[model samples]
Target: MSNSKLFILDDDRKTRDLLLAFLTYQGYDTTIVDNDVGFFDAPSPPPRTLITDLPTLLARMPNILKTGADNDLVVIAYDKAESARILPQDERWLFMPKPLNLDELESMVMRAQEYHALSSRNPDPPADEYPHFLCSTIIGKSRQMLHLFEMIEKVAESSATVLIQGESGTGKELAARAIHQLSGRSNRNFVPINCAAIPEDLLESELFGHVKGSFTGAYANRAGRFEIADKGTLFLDEIGDMKANLQVKLLRVLQTKEFEPVGSTRSQKVDVRIIAATNKNLEEQVANRDFREDLYYRLSVIPITMPPLRERREDIPLLISHFLGQFNRDKRRLVKGFSRESLEILCNYSWPGNVRELENLVERMVTIKESGFITPDDLPEKYLPTPSLAPSAPAGVSLPEPTGIEELPAAGICLNSAVDAFESRLIQLALARTGGNKKEAAALLNLKRTTLIEKLKKKNLQAS
Candidate 1:
């Protein structure tokens, strides 16, 4: 009944006849191709969907898909064994057993059509423009991430000290690397050291090289992070955890661009760019006198904060796709994608561990699932929606009982303040109930997702 077109290719004559007859009845403009001969050479507009057998599909591949030129086209391949062996890894390509159910095939076709229509209406930015990966690791398309990318570009043009602040696993180090990669000193070494991981006694020697017999186990002269990263960038991770004595020594280096190695008075001058990152609040640490105020000021010359995953839920799907592709290729798995329900739960759950957690989950799922789409049942118990008896409320909010206007205080109440409080409480409860899932929370509050986001932004309310 519609104008959607389909092309079928199969070596078997009977199979081709059955497909042609069934697909015609399904109201598709159908064409039967014997082989890749005329199919690739034909001048006619390419069909929206292509149904082929395993052999033919593999024989023409990369050419058939045309290296993403035919990305819009969906290809369904069927085989007797139902194996994904040697199947090209593509989201648009799906595999089914030879004795396929007609209804399921029809459903897949319909879903492909719908997806194509939606994509055409609101096309995503080119793969190159957004989802810019640093060493093929960091990736996202959310407004926050795009803004972060812009900031990285601008920051790359300068030599100012950079301080990256975010929770653990939020990719602060990756951002620092991105800056180095885009900077003028990219050809030079990029050295990284975790201040918290190393002991205070050894950290000084680690930062400033120790000469032979400088201290216990100092066999020979060695270059420190600063010396190794000369004319390059040194990423000091967990900067907030560095000891006060070491902080003073680090500050001197940042101030004068020179340092004396442990047990050596010879001052060495080095041109090294400093880029520090911390999971802790450095400003708070400085206020508490745990970190040097001068060092904090020096490191924060150009501060960059990475937003948490929950704050940018729009990027979850993109992150999942990126992870899925990566893991599939690495593990040699054929995980087509996640089910809609599974994705909804994943997008809503608070990723305390951030991108690292998501990547791990994808890799685990790909390893276990091996092939086919991942379903809700495949997720862990913690990720599943559980029934709660208590009234759902955010961590800092409590649900209030019904109150009557007659109970109004004699002193009178600020109506606007009271209304705002009530609205905020309800929003908090919804978010808590949905496990910080904005889409689910919005549904519970009877508000559009965008409207809920705006309210949360205006009130500065956290999902937790």
Candidate 2:
């Protein structure tokens, strides 16, 4: 592989060194020079690309922007109080934030390389599509999520009935709202009713309007969600839980765009868009004769399925940052963010509750934890004490274990380098013992499965 030449200017040696090490590991010919007024004076081979913080870049803007006009440049700026007051508006420039989100960095590097090859356009995102209106308030740019956004955008342009499916807490309601907000009827009201939340007896009246004395308790004229949602969208949540008899009535509305109010013979005309969501498998419900097949087809003119959180792990960090900012404002707290170790614990967890669960956890953590970064220690009990890297001997089997490092040169050793080497070796041994079954290997090593996978990547090893 051909390595890209990179130049970095940052007075902070620790940050510079970390970037240097990471870029070097990624096969980049990287060099760091003193970040001062005369930054362009670095020797023989001049930099073709540059990476620097906002303060340093602003102090040297004229020359740097001049140089950037001819070469690719990346600006890492801080947000909030110490933020770059005004972001650069040049297409040639790609702006990102720091102290650093490694995923964002990696994506930036890959896209920059593609840009240099003239095969890709700048990958810098717009100021924002802003916050998503989707359920659980979707936040991500992972391939899976990007595709979902595309699907939502396309479906929103029309009046097609929608059926959203996913596991509980997967944001089905959010998706429904997103579709409505993006549609032509955005200015109109969006009515949402939970099929499962309402009593079966009241659901029919709740959906289709009721005139006076429709049933035993219908004392006043009432507009149902469908009528209330006329000229807009009606969200039917937990739609799979809707009874078969009600499903027939729903199908009639879908077919004629009209329905009669209870206790009234006159049919009322309606122009409402339908967006239905459910956590249960509607197809299974149909097979079990619990749901009507004809109604299912009518309601599902367009189907959208949301993948669970575990499938889109890349979004974890972005979600982390987003939630931190979100709760900070809503709860009026000043919790900074997560410590690296705490972030690792979060990313490794299999979020069975999906984005909703993650959001709730962040809110809880920020609320209870004191002002400052959320560290491994500050994390809840279940997340603390990352799994051990060393495996224990089986109950009946005994094996000789390494005692300690015996050899040391006259010069004192680097403890971190030594620990990394030891950890890498033990991980390999554990993997071999488990026949490359990562879950089993993680168990053998007493590590969380996600923790082990990350270690495997850092060690340049393949994981099962």
Candidate 3:
């Protein structure tokens, strides 16, 4: 059986005792708290779930939230709309009504247990390709991430060119750096250039050096990214945006490793590893004659796709806690963590901007909240759950209603498409709640691990 603890809080000694006994019988190690003091004063907070009664819940709410939010603790309270309102709209405090049904409670706890398990088993970062170069700074425990880490390790030993693909904000640059760091060129410099960010006129000089007076206003000789990255790695970001003319020159470098400076007749020979990234479909660009097929093939010796934040919602809480820890240290603020409602809003929204967007959100919350706690009200309007869609209870708090999902908009999407979307969401939530452990997701959803694997495949998701 999984190792998880549950805390039962009730003013009535009888209710607390009853829960402790029943929960213990069902294989959960239980802790009992009867008053406001125990709720806040536990020397080392219990490892498992916090299940509390309404009266004790309200008396020490703000403090409970502050403590739990600060520490990454999960709070479960008997849901009453009025009672839930007293707590902040953060994701840490979960609510379900009292007069408990053992089955439903077990289900909820089971899901929570899986999340804890998955989160605890994070993968190691890949080794650097160059001796001193390290891998990515991202923190994630999702199966997808762990698998990606493994792939980075396997590919780092080779000299094959790498193509990193993903939407903006998904950290393609970080992934490319990780590959280079883990590869054979860790001691060498990793030069990066954004093809789309520079004008066509300047881009040529950026990749290949220009001698003094190569063109108008070319005052002195300047080395390009290729010259600087000699025997190192050159990271070409937004490769799809390169002009057709430049694509031919770039292709030659990949094939011959030889190029002349803009004005110099001397052909400079340089050995460098190339890593390229793009958010656009290179194949389509090739078909349109925008991107050269030869260049595409040369750059795609190995390919890695970074999943978007929305596709991996299971990592939201971890991301939140990680960000909070960072802000806490940087600001020296006592602000604990997100209220249950805040987390729910975060997980539900489609993060069109990916992880970068989430980082901005956290920074914004830190700047705005005067007190230590990050309340739901601090969230941007786009992230707030609509009143119609919002649960009657606070965020992270679940109601006793039969469905955990919100009803779909009637007119927008067809039922099958809706199911696909919901299934994707549910899998993400299960993964997020389980800290990215598919085994735990399977257990929570009461499916075989293999079944979860199939669903992931059907949804175009990677299972670690």
Candidate 4:
């Protein structure tokens, strides 16, 4: 096997020398540099990882990153404090607190080397799509989501108004924001106003500007969501919840690009691209005379419907990882990720609340839920489903056990055995998905770290 090289940067000569000797003894081609500048200017060492102390390391990272190392390059930061501060934690970066446990350090260094070797042996991510749009915020690879992304790319350049329709908590707002970001108006503001959140009396004033003495509490002339979003995108959320009177005014503005303030006679005009979203059925509301027909047509110019979370079950694991990383930043919980069984439950559960529900569930698991691998029971009662829908006994029906293991009756699998098998399979899958990070797996499973470990033990499973 080709030798792996490691570099050390530190202010203290003694510490740098010690690490250099230790790494050399571990069968590595090691180099010691006295300052960050020297480290940056060092001759391009064949694909190597770097280890250093934190004090000056972080201060000079931007420059070091500029002298880009091959993807094989990893960074490890060390400190003596009990809670070593690790900032901007990149996947290639590892952190260890000192008085360093030599064994753990060795294991970490070896693991980094192994990972680099494995990655180098695999195909690289496509260069053209390296920085995909909203790829960092929204994670999914299902055909449905891919098509949605394609549609977003198609509409990003045009100045067309977009209407995102979906069930509540399905991330309609996120979709709207994504559209704006990918469009030409990205540099401008994305003003969002929830029609259902504000009172009917204040909804009109909120959408359109109010002159100084327009209404009872209108003391000073105020710009509404439209004015603030001028030359930008205005997101009208819960548009279906707007009263009939407000709908007329909104429709007028869409058609005429002008509207009078609540109590002002002079009309105002603003070049704002309207992107409305709603969980309610505007067509039904229109049929029932609760919503205006003209308004519906105008708003539906570029309708983009977001699939409910349950409909796109394939995206659950990705969403779980995304949310876990978000919450784990502050929790400092060692919980690696989710166990398989927990993720199965999350995916199978009918997420009536959609993406919003899933996010809330993950947050609860990180903050107040049980620890270890998140188990089925750690989830909220609502997430478990009714007895009829439970994986063990479907529709309150029970199956007979196999007699003397005759042919191992496939139709008559025992509930305990079935659940166990399901959990075992899930754990294996989660581990494969996250490359064996228990905390990340737990997040994907929406389970606490401790609970995931317990479930793994019970199921007699080990992460690869």
Candidate 5:
């Protein structure tokens, strides 16, 4: 009764009759293909399942699995001998020996129907939706993430400096690597240095290289990150932590594209693209006179802000699946997936540490559980939802009395307008309660930060 059709191309009259009669009785719109050539010229909408002999299937593979053809097409090939050796390694294919069993054939058909139904309802996104570099890393499908991908692609086409700002563990470094990988200089080196991790005294030497006898410990000439990253990208992680003296030196390099090694008067010129990342707000640091204002402007030529995981909770499932598969392969475990209840808990919980935290949790669970679905009981206590102790109305807040139907005017009112007013009032109250902090207000209202921002823009409402 479903819109799934079947095509049979067995050639022999008896085999074709049996297949057609059986499939038709099973509620399929069945067609009998007289020859391999007729199968190609059969119809407009291709058959959902194709039952054919091994010879005919192999002869028409180019037509059956042609580019732009229906990817959900299932092929059931049968032959006298074992044909698994000749069949393609596609999951949509199945092989059966000549003396076909009707029950098994029915089971295979039912499975193909189920696969078609599932795929039709929620098909996997096209591989080309995001850049190939981003496919393996920086996994996300949220609106914010998609927009971020577009920005990274655009930025990669140029050689301008990029500033990636986000909270810790939000994958700023991954974004930098993606930009570098997509750029023309990807074939060259992608040098990275953590400014905060290195000592202040030797940070300059590490960046600009050092000549032999430049300092007590300098035994031989060494190339810095800038020299090594020539014609490529240099990712300066935690750029905000760089000291004031280093900030001036870095600013000079950005302005001139040149720097002198430690204890060397000769200047070295290099074509290195700079990509800086920081967990701290550089604008605030500029105001505090902690970071150089000129350097901040120079580095933020192409600014990118990565949203926290809480703001894009829809991506939690995808991230979980990716990490699950990754850890499963690396640890040689067979952890199936998280239970529905456990997954709901994870999606709703506030991930303060972002993607890295989720990845770690998945890895830990996969390692411990080994080969089963992760249940709520298997999760850490912090990840579990706790009972709220606060009353519906918190201590300093007052709730407005509910309006009764009797208060309605005789002329009645617009339901949508009333709903909009109520929603706007709640948003205002949440903003006031959080002291204009949009992130906290979003949490208080049980909304994503981006969703809250969109609502504010739609309603043209300001913080109370």
Candidate 6:
């Protein structure tokens, strides 16, 4: 019925039937073969794509891979966890985790088709030129997202510093992890530090390590982030908040690729790629003498700014569906995904807190909702199309106060003003609750500390 053929072999009958139906609907000429029922010896024609479980594939992994290459087939190997061991390193092979996501499977299928198309046009393109940028967590079909993926693919092999700028919760650290994962140093540790979360006084020791008795509470000779990230990537998140003195030292590291541990004169050399991120206006900070201009230049060798969630509205549905499937798996629940109306409302709402906020909201819904598809009625009041109370929140869970929402003047209030007023009040409350500790305040608000700091700077209330 279709131009492409796929073969699936699984011991579980349910899985086998599900794959058959799903792939068939996706326009594939699909067939199911049992591993114990002469599956390997079947006289069926070679399929262009093969999806198989770990044990069955493992039994004859080497032979299967060789046959696929000979027959010009691509293999999608998946299992709970063990399938990873037998996965081929060959170009024609792809890997999937247990409880495979349909969206990711579809993406892999598209890549397989692309491979066939490209191989016909050119017998061989470089192996790395293939679509290895198919991480399930990095879900998006928007142009900007595709562009970001392309950038990651291009720069992954290089050792240049990468600076990712974005509003907090837009997934800056996720991008950094993507870059590191696609790079040659993926096997090494990916060390990350929130520059804004740490105190300015102790930041030096955190970055450069310290000798025993280097300062107060320096109990032992320890390695710093730079040393730990050697042969890997060091993600300095919220780098804009780094102290001026540390900026100078960081610039020196970029220039010479070496640094001395605190209280020690001996210099230590390490090969580490730097990936810095910030939610602040680093350029403005430089102009204001609050940040070092030289360090800014050094870190921004290849700057990548993450697009806000609102800007990439096309990605919202995909992300929502992904988080839904994830939560369903986490809770072992059969909760259906969002209703069409709920999806529209979610798509229309401005995600000021970005992806993290949406993800948090989804987790809450999946945990709290008892039955029925996630309808618009299930969403919080602020997110609703009309102001209405949601179901009673769980015990001990404090919902945001709806104070002043009920009453309105005859002409009604500007929605923007109302929302901002409410947000400001919540932020101040959280700040006070945490005793002015921005890190704790951010955690209490389920926000990144840098985001909280930016809000403070915006309100000119840093002194408060």
Question: Model 5: per-residue lDDT, tens digit, 136-192?
Answer: 798888888887877776668667788999999999999999999999999999999
The Cα local distance difference test for each model comes to 0.79, 0.72, 0.73, 0.72, 0.81, 0.76
Ranking by lDDT: 5, 1, 6, 3, 2, 4
Off by over 4 Å in 2: 1-136, 384-396, 399-464
lDDT of 4 at 128: 41
- Each candidate structure's TM-score, on Cα atoms with residue i matched to residue i, is 0.59, 0.57, 0.56, 0.55, 0.59, 0.57
lDDT of 3: 0.73
**Ten consecutive residues with minimal summed lDDT in candidate 4?**
399-408
TM-score quality measure for candidate 2: 0.57
The best candidate in terms of lDDT: 5
* Tens digit per residue, CA lDDT, model 6, 1-464: 22456778777788888888888887877787655355545566444677877475565767855675336577777863565566546657776666766655765665565445434443433444444234545767777777777767656766768889999798899899989999999999999999989999888999999999989899999999999999999999999888878888998998789999999999999899999999998889977999886677667656788998877888888898888888889987777889999998888766768899999999989988844699887888767543222323333433346453355545555665556656676776665544355776798789998888898787555413
Clashes of 3: 28
Clashes of 2: 3
Candidate 3's displacement at residue 145, Å, is 0.9
- Model 6 scores worst on lDDT over the 10 consecutive residues at 386-395
Q: Candidate 1's residue-wise lDDT over 1-464, tens digit each?
A: 22446888777788889888987887778888766665655666533677887574565676767765565677777863432565657756766665756644665565455445444544444444865455465677777888788678666866778899998989998999999999999999999999999998999999998999998899999889999999999999999999999998998998789999888989999999999999999878976999886687678766799999877888889889999998899999999999999999998787877888888899999999999999999998767765433433434444344243345555656666666767776787677666677887898889999999999999887764
Model 4, 248-311: lDDT tens per residue? Answer: 8887888688888777888988888899999888879977988876677667656788887766
